[model samples]
Target chain A: MRYFNNPEALLRLVSSMQEGFAITLTIFFATLLFSIPLGMVIALLRMNRHRAVSVPVSLYILVMRGTPLMLQIFAIYFAVPMLTGHNLERMTATILAFSLNYAAYFAEIFRGGIMSIPVGQYEACRVLGMRRSQTFFYVVLPQVFKRVLLPVSNEVITLVKDTSLANVIAVGELFRAAKNEASRTASIEPLFVAGLFYLIMNGLVTLFFNRLTQRMSYYRD
Target chain B: MLEATHIRKSFGDTRVLKDVSLRVSRGEVVAIIGRSGSGKSTLLRCLNDLETVDGGEIRIGGQALVTMQAGQPVYKKDGERRALMLKMGMVFQSYHLFPHCSVLRNLTMPQKLVLGRGDGEAEAKARDLLAKVGLSDKAGAYPCQLSGGQCQRVAIARALCMDPDILCFDEPTSALDPQLTQEVLGVIRRLAQEKRTMIVVTHEMRFARDVADRVIYMEDGVVVQDGPAQEVLGDHRSDAIRAFAGE
Candidate 1:
């Protein structure tokens, strides 16, 4: 509480937390940039008729979803390098782990969205003389995105909090910086400040998704 | 012209179309009427290549869609099938009007993507067709925004924008109430007066009798009777057709 009365200490905490927040933002944005499209590809692979492709994808999804994300971070940061004889930088390991893990969740969400579309859409595209790829990209994906937007927004909001898990690998992101600040200053105020940052980031994400949903409201199911 | 000869199809153990053959010449409006599960819709689907025939042949404008070779049906190649489909258009019972797009886009997208028309040209043609269908005001609306009647009209205009040689409709009015049915059937009646070539599978006896030059009565997966509309619908000889026509 005394830390709140000290202007210099509060300014120091905000400035240091700002640097950590930048890394946190980078992780959040990079994970989304990589995972979303990769999730769509994995969803398509999961939907493939061939057992050889679908079976392995199913297993990958199972492992990713069933295991703890923190454990996955450790395995990627430590075990992967030991097993492969190639070391990944701490931030690289964190991003690789977060992206692949979230992609599994996004893939299932996408599959559900794609499957929810009525069969009539595909028939309409086919009768219109559109090839399969054209139908999927133009006719199907737009509708799928509309239907999946809410669920995807939920996953994306979860991703904001999940970025904190990167701290388990000692990457010195937001939460780790906050923890270090608290220990150094012998005060819990920095932890509360870190929670506020998460709340603000998630609030912005919610507002962004709400705007997207409104723009897409022109067409209903 | 469209010719479907000995078209046979089945779903698992149940046969939907059995040796069904039909011939429709240019500028003819043919209506196939029957009880549900009589394969009327399935025949229309086969013509559009929505369902591959288990055995038989279909030729559109003298181009073979499918032919029998070595005891199996050989369908046209992908490019050939696409080209053949370009010459035909279909409207479904559900209206299937790409619900995510505006009414104008539903008509214009296919023209731009399939026919390679420029965007302005496609939009101009779409506007014209929308006006013809009495929906020029609803061009900015989505299919979900329109009533069942209005959606069907948009669907019709969407199909016609392709400038196809033939148009197919599968129970277009089956999903509509009486007033909405009239709204759709009125559009069909006008198209018929314009001498457009169309093949429609309908449950509306009156629309079939009025708009079609040829009326085909189907029963148990085969064409039981086919003749001029006046002769067949007015002076039908089959018991099934009489019961269905409510005579």
Candidate 2:
């Protein structure tokens, strides 16, 4: 209470946590950057009619989705280092784990979106003499993005909170910084401020996705 | 303009088309009519390469799209096949327009992408076809914003924008109510009067009798009757054909 009550002290505390907040944002953006496209590729491969291509992708998705994300983080950070006789940087390990886990979930969502498009759409493109690539990029993918926006928005919100899980491995993200400050000052004020940070970040995320959804509402499947 | 001979297709163990054959000269309108499981649609699909015939030869616009090689059907190389297929356009039972695109864009995008037409040319042709289908005012509307009949008309205009030599409709009015069906049939009727080559797979008995120069009736995966429309639908036909005609 005494620490938070002092304006200078509160300012110092917030400034100190800024580095950790940036790290959290970095994790969030990096995970999404790698995961979204990777998920699309995986989803396409999963839909392949041949077993040789699809079987391994389905198993990979199963393992990634069936296991706990924290355990995945631990394995990538600790177990990989031990098995390879080399250490991964904490941030690299954390981002890698987060990207891989989120990609599995995104893959499933994309699969549903792609599958929901009717066969007639493909036939229409086919008889029009459009190439397969043209059919996918122009005719199919835009509709897919519209259909999967709600589920994708849900996953994005979950990702904002999931960034805090980095603290389990001492990655010193915003939540970890606030945890350290709370202990140092023997006050819960820092923890509440951390909660505020997460809320504000998630609020911005919600706003961005809501605007996207609104822009696309003009078209319907 | 189109010739298919000895077309045979099967799904697993069930034969959907067994030795079906048809030929259409330029400026011909052929209506393929039959009961639900009689493979009428399958034969039309085979012509358009929507369904590959297990064994057959298909020639469109005097170019071979597929030929019987040994015991199986072998399609032409991809580039050649696509160019040949571009001479034909297909409209589905359900209007499968790109819902995200306006009616004008739906008609123009394929021309730009597939034919490499300039935007000016594509848009000009799109507007012309839209007017032809009585949809000039609805150019900016999305498919979902239009009624069933309006959407079907837009689909016809979209297919026409490509300047296909033979237009194929797979039960174009099966998904429409009678009123909506007439609006679509009216567009087809106008196209027929202009002497556009077309093949329609439909259940509309009167439309087939009136509009189709030749009617090919299918039953149990084989051509049961094939002749001039009036001759087949008029007197001197089998009881099966009479019963199918509902008289």
| TM per candidate | 0.97, 0.96
List the DockQ of the predictions in order.
0.84, 0.90
Model 1: colliding residue pairs: none
The number of the candidate with the highest DockQ is: 2
Report the C-alpha lDDT of model 1 over A104-171, residue by residue, as the tens digit.
99999999999998999999988889889989988999999899989999999999889899989888
Best by TM-score: 1
The segments of candidate 2 whose C-alpha lies over 4 angstroms from its true place after superposition are: A1-11, A82-86, B235-238
**Model 2 chain A weakest lDDT span, ten residues long:** A1-10
Candidate 1 lDDT tens digits, B89-195: 99999988888889988999988888899999999999999999999999998888899999999999999988889999999998999999999999999999999
Writing each residue's lDDT as its tens digit, candidate 2 over B1-247 gives 8999999999999999999989999899999989999998888888888888899899987889889878888999999988989999899899799999999999999999999999999999999999999999999999999999999999999999999999999999998999999999999999999999999999998899899999999999999999899988766766888898787
Task: Give residue B28's lDDT in candidate 1 (0 to 100).
Answer: 100
Residue B190, candidate 1: alpha-carbon lDDT: 97
Best prediction by lDDT: 2
